[model samples]
Target: MLIRDLPEDVVMEILSRLPVESLMRFKCVNKAWYFLIRNPDFIAKHLFWATSEKRHRGLLLNREHEITRTPWVSLHSNETLEVSRYVDLLQFFPRDVGELVVFGPCNGILCLFGVPADRNGPRDGLVLWNPATRESKALPIIQRPAEMPTTFPFRFGFGLDPKTGDLKVIRILNLNFRRCQVEVYNLSTDSWRVINTSVNPIYRINSPRFPSYLNGVHYWLACERGGPDHWLMLSFDMSNEVFQEIALPSLTERPSFEAVAVINDSVALILAYNDLATRFYYICVMNESGEEKTWTLMFTIGPLLHFTRLIELRDDGFVLLRNKNGWLVLYDPITQEQRELPIYGDSFQVVSYTETLVMLNGSGECA
Candidate 1:
């Protein structure tokens, strides 16, 4: 029998096993195949199989320099952490936009915030990009409040609302260390709505660090002032559009650097103390979500000499690290082994990446 004559279920099964690049080209063969590949149900099935099979493992490295570039480094082995290839991202963006800040990669779509090279150029500053399919959509410009201070730093969080299957972007305008304005943009509506919820007065977030998204929620490391340094985990639920705080484990001394990340489907905290004096590092994993008592010390590595930043935690007992010299190194906490990856770049921002066929047109609809 011919390929086209195959049953719908069989066709979908075969298509799901193929890479996204192949499927994108296959869609052009015929309208029947185009609609079939673009179907929401098929996309979900492909994603499920891709994740469970671990087929799309890679590293997205953002190289910051005169001409910013994003290169996707494919990971082949967890033990060796070998780089398979470096995929250039220049084709995914426009010519005029140079500097782009990537937000989240929830469900394969990366939300990007960029400014035009020319200050007064006409362009959509915000964009949604799907690297697997090479599809991108520039979102409309957001209007700020009249009274909002010009110098107020803006923080953004991107995630998908599992309840409604809507892609939402949460923007927080920090007017000061204590108070701020919050807004949410719904992809389906193509508009931004000002959320009346105010951030907790006791906690203040570090805007320079990006928020981590896991299971339809965004997490940020926040600190409380006045007495001793108190760090807390701040979370925003995209499904319900609400905010909550989770307390961190007690610390004798404030960590010089701290960030929140997801490890093995649970929230994990990476803390580094006094880089100048101490070579000790700490990794704390939460046994249960939203529970302060469940936080447990996972690992403590000592004499790590310049390994200062934790880029990501791998499933096979290894953690990706960035030393003070700014090189990417793979360190095994269990075996006490360390090796530097052969990725050459001036500056690198690494993020966990998985390739998918998720559409960026609107919500989950195909363009």
Candidate 2:
């Protein structure tokens, strides 16, 4: 029977199961389909299916170009590193938009901040991109929070507000060693607002852990001030717009973290410490509900692999690492195998990426 002859409910089910590229083309199939594809409810439904565990997974690998050295990120198969979609990030913006700071893929929407190469040419800007649909929206700039006097660069954290289903990005400005100015941008309203809070002592979510936005919260592993350097996780709840401090396991009062990642929707830290001149990686998961947070040591990784740098720890049994040759490698914990990628760059930026129908509202520039 023709797709039109199928019941609308059955049709929705079939369309939702199809990949995002297929769904985008179906919008041109018929008026009924075009409306169905654009429906917010249907978009959310499609996202839910796309993120399922049984579905085939991909990686969003961000690295500098091997030859020209221009920064670019691409979508590739998790196992083979076979690129399916290549995104030349700067190509989407005006010539002066410049190099970009990559943020989250929170529900498939990875936000980018264009750091203008020529200040006199174009202003520094922000772009919301869904690599799956190749749709991008240029966000209007608002008055940013005042800069912190500290020489360290400020940061932006992105996440989906669980309570409202709204996408939000937070700009954190460290005011001192003590206070931080937080500014939030809401995607639905396309507006920015500064948050008022008594959140104290300026716990920072550093760059090494910038990808830690999981389960509606943004997290960073931070070191306490003074003394011998203690450890804590600073988390910002997107829905509540509040910050919380989570203590780590007391292992000589320090845990050497390689990276922070989300596994099965829970935040996990990859710890690399030396054991009798042999370096190893440890996975620790947190229990967030109790009065005191607990960290459970999940497992240990090693036989001293030739990996020179630890890039990222993916949720599934894969670890993205780099070697002395400056190439990326995917390590599977289950198979105890390693596969090297073709690209060559020193920048270690790779994230486990899943396709989604989010931000395909047809209101943005077709990427």
Q: Per-candidate TM vs. native?
A: 0.83, 0.88
Please report, in order, the local distance difference test score of every candidate based on alpha carbons: 0.70, 0.72
What clash count goes with each model? 0, 0
Winning model by TM-score: 2
Q: How much is 72 displaced in model 1, in angstroms? A: 11
Record all residue pairs in model 1 with backbone atoms less than 3 Å apart, i.e. clashing: none
lDDT of 2: 0.72
Model 1 bad stretches (over 4 Å): 1-5, 66-99, 115-124, 144-151, 208-211, 225-228, 275-278, 289-293, 362-367
List candidate 2 stretches off by more than 4 Å.
53-56, 66-69, 95-99, 118-123, 142-151, 176-178, 201-204, 208-210, 253-255, 275-278, 305-307, 360-367
Model 2, C-alpha of 331: deviation from truth (Å): 1.6
Error of 1 at 90 (Å): 7.2
